[model samples]
Target: MDDLVTLWPSAREASEAEDVPRRVMITGSEGYIGSVLVAKLLDGGFDVVGLDTGYYRAGWLYNDGKDRPRLLARDVRSLCAEDFEGIDAVVHLAELSNDPLGAHDVRNTYEINHRASVAIACNAKLSGVRRFVYTSSCSVYGAAGDDMVNEESTPRPQTAYARCKTLVERDLMRLADVDFSPTFLRNATAFGVSPRMRFDIVLNNLAGLAWTTRRIAMTSDGRPWRPIVHVEDICDAIQATLNAPRGAVAGEIFNVGTDSNNYRVSEIADAVAQVFPESEITFGDTAGDNRSYRVSFEKIRRHLPGFRCAWDVHRGARQLRALFEHVGLTEEMFLAPPYTRLRELRRLVESRQIDSDFRWRCHDFS
Candidate 1:
């Protein structure tokens, strides 16, 4: 299983048949999705460097140092050319992440999500790396109404975090003057557990609510269709980007997910209840952020048709339920004031746990 993660195409298959061995950098390496990605990259044989501040807590990256080429503990603001000195591609995943969390500190979200991202792009260019991937979200599509969104869809980011992602994407595109090989993945709402356990995502939250209260809360009518992907498939998408031809991905945006992964919130609640059997599912009158619509993964899959999606939502929720049980999560897990309220990036600043001006240095782009 590990051997397959780093598998590269043959030299003759490289279109140009060049001999540049791929070396990739994954930021946010310790987060929920990133940690799983790190494992895949290492097992696939890519010289992978994981750059993270370890903000997701200690257990988040327990697998680090075992398989990755390197892991750097540093803030994004401190990223410089030397940081990416020998890297080939950059997967930028560092962010304040999502609406509830961003609402905690809009300023912190903007600074880290946009400003620091632009800095990373510049460094990637300076360090001579070609491919650059920014992990954007389908939430940038805002309230989809009933529209089926493709890459051509104009982003209507509805939250502080979504808007911040849109802004960074713009900055990265602007630097196309440097001929940066930019690939934007407006990923679907991601779920499933990783080394970093986030109870915040929909499926995880629903499973948690089901476990404790026997009822999963629906913020709204729960009728909006949402695209979701398991963490493993997201890693596959990143690996696909890493190996795709330079011309195939340069200056392009692809919605990364599976068509079949789309599900209504009410549907997700129902699935969770069915999987657990003992849990009861309930719904609300409406959704909180007012965002809904299914996203198409055709662009990415058609381009890289060989890519595979292994985990579906039903199986994914069951996997998460077992994980929650294994972790011994308590009712107070989400009941605490702010960590419970949501991860407050701004309060992180006030608490001085975050060092904003800490010289964002480069880790792996040359």
Candidate 2:
């Protein structure tokens, strides 16, 4: 925290030094979204400190068997209360990630996703951090009932991942009283080649299946409406928030994706098929199962004022095909042991493959 205060002019310039430019502390800094977000923040001239306890190491795309970024490997939970110094704001991107991983240990999910989050927020606020940007998920607004779901729509979270994000969103509203301008960024399901590549997302997964298996499977009937955005776009939205005029963003909840980006899983698959000509596609039987709704992105655009997204699903798919070829991932190459098998996080823990303090938070929450 001394580093943050040092930027201020001498005591003679009290008012000038009072409002410091944002020095962002990005937890989960090396993960799928966090790593991309880090680069964006750095490029945008924000002094950034990254924290990542590499529990899931495969998702890191920036690691080129060479020098990596200046990310401290520390568990979010293990962060000393004193560790909160010099931070101007926080972009909390660390968590158990998705449903399957959260399900591996519900307790681990709640503790890390919920408890640890509150801890970070509390510490950061106590340490005089001003803005808190949390990367939430639109999945909390589950199984939408109409043509489109907007911010006013009720969030019906069905899984632990969605539920945890919703819980954080709720709590963030209260952080306003602590002088922390908390903003909830409910992002759409991200898919694309980012500094940290995630083949787990829908479009990326389909591209993977198409590339290796020559087939893509759809169980959500290919009819469910899903709001999709590229990872870069999501990071761009976060960058827009740093020291933004408080009214447009402070203590606000905005759905972060473009209206033009929602696509039917089937439509997306077909699009990917066209992009990857060798692929065959098949739709599964649950067409009427009802977890579908287009999302209205006008609220964020008109209100946030400066918000914009680059790379819709179509552009993201092409990038994935290129990444696949570059990585030399072939049909004979099954996903890395930890790629598809999320439970391997446990074995990763035992092997000391990552910082163990994080694994301590990985048990079943329920």
Candidate 3:
């Protein structure tokens, strides 16, 4: 780790002329948030390069007609320093994205999310890629009730996915010297329409249920505190991190999303019910999943002046409702394997498209 940290220029030396990054590389550019972030960076006048393993390529919800960046169809696990050559910054988002997906295979989760991620960061630093914005999750504060947790609070990761996040953050921060600045954005649960629309997340799933069956039948008591933000707002936070001075963001952990956006699972359901008025809501008495947390996003607002959530739960739900009507979303579309990460991966494994280690078979690669 020390040997890798010494490869980059001193932070003090680099900070003298830290202009906004002009060339950026976004890993997982074909995934849910990556799809939206690619357009955002392109529109903002940055030269963007995208890299993804194309696991979820089968899912394209709608055509937004926006111009896309140059994409490298490659796995993050196989990336080396040469791939980051000439790249000024990296927004790393590729991994088993959520708690359930992480639980699908715990060993593979650590391999991809923790080990591969740290390897990429080391490669980035070695290649003199100064700015690294890592997308972490607020899920690290697992099971922390009522009281809001901040970046300084101790993380109690409940699942393999969340544990990988904390582990990656820990290892990456050790590499943060005067030369390489790595900022961790602990994003709230993400929702909103994308070309790679996901029905696995809370808001989108509830809206899909409402559109398809006109009912939200929750198996749990719906009492867990969950904070959600629009997918676009997450992109906004990334932009802010990349544009900020090295000193302001280096080795920093900021919880992305507004404080007001935090909501109990029942409250989120209520908001969804309001958007799709025809949907009937029902809940079971038991708390089925123990992963729950209310996060404080005050540090991001205080530090990154440009960062703020534009959409709340109600507005995001309304956006999903509009999208459902526009696309004429059907039950089959909502339940498609590609829209849900774990389902698509399972399908790939079962069909021999990808190996048990999640690598694509050579013949299956286009």
Candidate 4:
């Protein structure tokens, strides 16, 4: 922790010595969304710094040949105010991502997802960072049925992960002030190809199943509504939030996705089938996972006028199919441990690479 904090003191001095470009720090910079967001911010002419614990670093699906930012290979829980001193904004995405991973150990989930995230926001505020973009989830509206839930809707989180997102949003709102403006972007379910690919998400998982085995075997009846947005679109929302005026975004919670992007589980499967026509599809009678919600993204469209979703589910499906065909994806590759968050974390804990608390036992885990 000291070593990581010490490295940023020189960065602070350099920023104080002269005017610099807008410096934005992203936690979980090496993960699925962070990788894409880092590239987007760089292309937009922002000085980017990334911090990731490198849990999913082993999973590189494909290289996009984009320049990456200077990454700090450190845990979010170990960060302090000094680490964020020179940063103008902090995009917090470093957490145990998704539901099953959170269910694997509920205690650890709250520790990192809720408590540690709040701590990081507090640190960022203390260090004089002006803008904070928190990558929240639409899953906070869990089990809303057919009724479209918006930012004002009461959150009925059904999992540790979703619950923690709510907790962080609540806690961080208290840290918001005239100087520290925190924006909460409750992003829709993310799908689309990335260098650090994840097959655990609904659309991505279905696409992977369709590609590898030519079969999408569903465990549920596929009746629940899910609002999903492309990975790139999620990045676009983050960029928009960063560039938007502080008064417009501060203490605001915007669901990130378009109104038309919400689809029933069965529809998502059908879209994937269209991309891979040879794939067989089946669904069970039971609702396997209870978490489901249809989110209204009108607030973001109204608040951030420049933000718009560029990729829909169909386009995102085609993108995945193209990448899969280009890479010649096989069943083994699709079922790889790192592509799924729960599987990879379990492997680490069982192999003693990371301890019970999810800390790396050694620096040479790779």
Best by lDDT: 3
Q: Order the candidates by lDDT, highest first — what do you get?
A: 3, 4, 1, 2
**CA lDDT, candidate 1, residue 163:** 93
Clashes of each: 22, 9, 3, 0
TM-score of each: 0.86, 0.86, 0.94, 0.93
**Candidate number of the best TM-score:** 3
Q: Which of candidates 2 and 4 is the stronger one according to TM-score?
A: 4
Per-residue lDDT tens digits of candidate 2, residues 212-303?
Answer: 89898766678888889888888878876664554557788889999988898898898898888887898888643455667888878866
- Candidate 1, residue 79: lDDT: 86
User: Candidate 1: minimum summed lDDT over ten consecutive residues — where?
Assistant: 336-345
- C-alpha local distance difference test of each model: 0.75, 0.75, 0.89, 0.88
**What clash pairs does model 3 have?**
10-178, 11-178, 11-179
Weakest 10 consecutive residues of candidate 4 by summed lDDT? 1-10
lDDT by residue for model 4 (1-366), tens? 223322322223344433222799999999999999999988887889999999988899998999999999999999999999889999999999998888889999999999999999999888989889999999999889888899999999999999999999999999988888888999999999899999999999999999998888776789889889999999988876766556778899999999999999899999999999999999877544887788899888877767789988899999999999899899999999999999999999999999999999977557
Question: Which 10 consecutive residues of model 3 have the lowest summed lDDT?
Answer: 2-11
Q: What is the C-alpha lDDT profile of model 1 across 162-261, one tens digit per residue?
A: 9998888888888775356788988888788776667678887888888877788877788888888888888888878777666767788888888888
What value does the lDDT take at residue 233 in candidate 3? Answer: 98
